[model samples]
Target chain A: MTSLYAFVAGPLAWAAFLFFFGGLCYRLLSMLRQVRQSEPFIFSYMSLRYSLRSILHWLIPFFAMGWRRNPILTGVTFIFHISLIAAPVFIVSHVVLWDEAWNLSWWTLPDAVVDVMTLVVVAACLFFALRRVLRPEVRFVSDASDYLLLVLTAAPFVTGFLAYHQWPAGPWMTIAHMVSGELLLALIPFTRLRHMLSGWLTRAYIGSEFGAVRHARDW
Target chain B: MNERHKEPSEIMDDGVEAALSRLTPEKIQAVINSVLKGETGARFKAYMDTCIHCGLCSEACQFFLSRDRDPHYSPVGKVKQTVWPMVKNKGRVDTDFIRRAVRIAHTECNLCKRCVAFCPFGIDIAYLMTVVRRIIHKLGATPLYLQDTAHSHASTMNQMWVKEDEWIDTLQWQEDEARAEIPSLRIPLDKEGAEIMYSVIAPEPKFQAQLIYQAAAIMHVAGVDWTMPSDIGWDNSDMAMFTGDYEIMGRIKRTHFEAATRLRVKKIVMGECGHAFRSVYDTGNRWLGWAQPPVPIVHAIAFYYDLLKTGKLRIARKYSHPVTLHDPCNVVRGGGLHEKARYVVHQLCDNLIEMHPNREHNYCCGAGGGVINCGPPYKNARVAGNRVKAEQLFDAKSRGAHTLIAPCHNCHSGLHDIVHHHGIDLEIKFFSDIIYECMEKPDGSE
Candidate 1:
């Protein structure tokens, strides 16, 4: 078990990070090249003012028209995303691990807060899963991969929650948590999760188009 | 999946029906594959990837809102029904699928970009719908009436099939009619070096020639130097854009721009039409590889706004009726003329009752994007789809707005249908119509 943990925590973790960053760079560069070749005018209309305006409005909960219309989804989306990012970065254990590995550390969240965040993420994932399975509009667009992506997103948090609490299969859960988290990071650049990066580019393109050319607010 | 199995309305679109009859699987595969592989690039990829399909865009769609929030009419739902499958299957779909896709892309969506404002990622479902339209157009499967309109544009450089002499005759007739009131008023034709080349949709000459008279009178009273083209490029409207015939769209826009360029006019001021403005300023220009219009294009709202703002055209008396404004999606949202439109309205009208979601966020009149051009067969669905717009009109009427000023031609026609169909008692008018009525005419013309 220790050897398996070492394998995942050592080379597997490095491979995951390398894949994540490298794949994102590759995708970004390729998209830029494609756009430059096809629609170079996108660059001309890209305005910093409008891009920031659009991105800032969308980041705020209920500030955007779409977010305001679906309050429940907005609440769930914000919570899930915040917790998904926050718990991983600020958890005491993760910080301690960073400190031990590279002598790197930032301000860590209280254990109780991260625990709550993890639970929120897990719950939000379930909410998303149920929405996909139940809502016809969501269901119509969702395939098995959507549900699988949700499970993948939720798995690390769920197993981490169980492992942190020292539940029935705590050690195994930790291993499962590490593996799932690594897998998710590796898969993100290839899947819809790449939206995390491309969404900003799209928002910028649209914002510039709406602002500079159309002279309208995209948000 | 708890998908509602409602009895789908049988819309007998002979264009789609006949196209489907001629289509073979190999042809479908080839056409879809070529468009997907050749035409689309990064914009397509980014949109397809970034959309998480959370269904947030559903509420932004009037089709969804009007239909009790049915998922099928949702912007993402439309994509799921049409383009997503095409992408997934690599264009291996059957004939029936193409028919349904034509209906969804052509009849269902207004391509208003309202959904873009609502999407968290700003995924352009309108762009995706246009892709489906592009594919359908390539396959020669566009709806019959809309195809006929495209054919007209291809053959005549106009959508209404107006001959050159007929166009000149219509202008002369309108000029003669306007002269009865303002004896000095003349609708100048083919006047080179004119400061402004005034262009209009072919419908103005065909069915709404009186609008041309009103425009002429407004121009005369305002003392603006403008001339109308009595040539092949006189009609500024391009139904081809909606039909996904970008070749014809490019040609039509080129002819319109070249007419203004040939006149050596400083600018082209188009009459009240949204899609035509979009064609000239945004889509048609881009397709023709121009980042900006070759000649400066001014929509009617902007022209009136300028005239009113600059005190060139003074209103003798503000219109004394309670009026509501319907912001056309292309101009208000697509052109950012919302504030200007409101300025023109407030200058002309005494009481301006605003719709619940006014300006950029207003509901589409359900007729833009060539849905209205699909003609009578789809009229019921077109009207049925925009029940929310009817409710808005009703709300405005209940608030004591007796007249509704829709600034775009398509919105004028679409709202006309809605008010008549829904028994909403609000009268419709263009900004030009109201301005022609309320502006100071030199000869006291009514």
Candidate 2:
């Protein structure tokens, strides 16, 4: 929350900004341009509905309503997503930064709770990585890019744990955490993780809308 | 209302056969390249630049998980093998590429777009595959059976070439058969200003005409106002979705909508079909450029919900049969009609056996997106691809589901194969059949 902290957060914040702004602008512009150039009919009764829903499906995971068939993976994935998403927002540092910078006054969890969630996130990521590696089908399908992303994801968690523990060295630990966090922000928009924003656009909204409009029988 | 015309047979095989022989390699390549050129040769370029290769999309794809994580079966890999080569070469790929892309795009992938759900970014691999299909169509490299279906659309305005008279005859025949069951069932055709204009894929008239009979009995019992066009729009299924024939797809959608419009109907109701519903609602209609359908288009799930909610239709007896529901990709996940479908199913069947992954997140029946229409050669592979689904069914069966209610025709067909292949010994029925059998009639004869 201090000027020094703000200064340190500058690069990390800018990296998030790039994903939030640059990544978003590029995706939206490209999709719109595709529509513009596509056959005019693509804009028909169902299309406008499709495009709108596709654009609106970010920030929500409505597809988890079903929990019967793919229960193990679905349940595990949902927990992982919740913990991973919550850690960054609910952590004390994130809360304090928001409090100092934006006058936000949401509750900040105690360090112990934050640490537990961070550990939970790391565990879930590891589990997913292990599944991807060990499962014959998953492993066979997984390419170098998958392993790279998993390792990259673990880097921040590893650094965060080291920094939290403040083992052996202090400044080095903090820098490590800072560097990994910055790297994660930079990598997000460039890789398949970019779908975090677009998946909702298609999966939840347009995906459903198209299904609804066409009367494609599902249930 | 009229005299017996002829047997309900496909109206066009000769013309399409003639065109098939003339389909030279040069013609096929020319068509494939034209579509590739349409995007400033940048469509594939953009796609390659866009992928992040995080297997997060694998979670979104049923085929990938169901297939035991075969890398080549992964959605991104699908793009890699089929379209990536063309994109890499900037469109100088040979016929071999065209031949294989056809199989991968049309036969292998179900176009469920479920991967779009789990995608970290919203890359619609379904849409990308569609692009590949378009290229295949242009190259004239489409599979034989699917090509025939596409030709059916181009010629008769319906995929199965059910002539106008045959469509009406099929309706009358269905009504006659249904009347034997209920003594008052009727299939109204070309009835103006009906509350619902019902449409179906040509297969209903061609092979599964009994569905029409069952639907008429359900409508009759419910006292619902519905009509079917005695014209081309009567065939709601669109092969354009399979062949990547946007024009045919669009025309089919417009014809369906316009038929409803012509009748001054309140809404267009589609039967149980996955890709057909997708085509009308998401793909084809969009190709024709409408924000939403001109008229409200309701899936059979929603329509039945309206009937049951209004209390116009009441069950005389619960079906007493134990049943499981197969969530067709288009209606359940894509349309969000899972809860409604459950209500109808549970009301009609005495015992409801829940599939492990019920509703939107359920496995595809392996026949949707015209995968079944790819024909018998790929049948075993299709079943193999859905080995996970078979296991899911067996798991549900262990809980005692003897009958399966599949609302979509494609699901019915696909699930039929899975049930047989898995040796589950389950009987498949449409939701309408149960409604017809159990719902009380106006006369209270039941």
TM-scores for chain B, listed for all candidates: 0.98, 0.90
Per-prediction TM-score, chain A only? 0.97, 0.77
Model 2: residues with Cα > 4 Å off, grouped in runs: A1-219, B1-50, B59-62, B179-185, B444-446
lDDT (10s digit) by residue, model 1, range A1-219: 889999999999999999899989999999999989987878877899989888888899998778888899999999999999999999999999999999999999999999999999999999999999888888888888888889989989988998888786547889988999999999999999999899999998888788888888877
The digit string of per-residue lDDT tens for model 2 on B1-446 reads 11122111111223223444566656655565677766432234344555655455665566776666777777887887876667556566555455557667876789876765555345567878988877766655566788789889889988887787888888888888777767766788889989989888899899889888777777777777899888768888887778777788888888888899998999888887767777777667666767666777788888888888889888888888789998888876667788899888877877898987666567788788877887766677778778888888898888998888999888898989999988987889888888877888776445
- Model 2 TM: 0.74
For the predicted complex of model 2, DockQ is: 0.16
Clashes of 1: 0
In order, the Cα lDDT scores of the candidates are 0.91, 0.71
Looking at candidate 2, what is the lDDT of residue B279? 76
State the DockQ of every prediction. 0.77, 0.16
Question: Which residue pairs collide in model 1, if any?
Answer: none
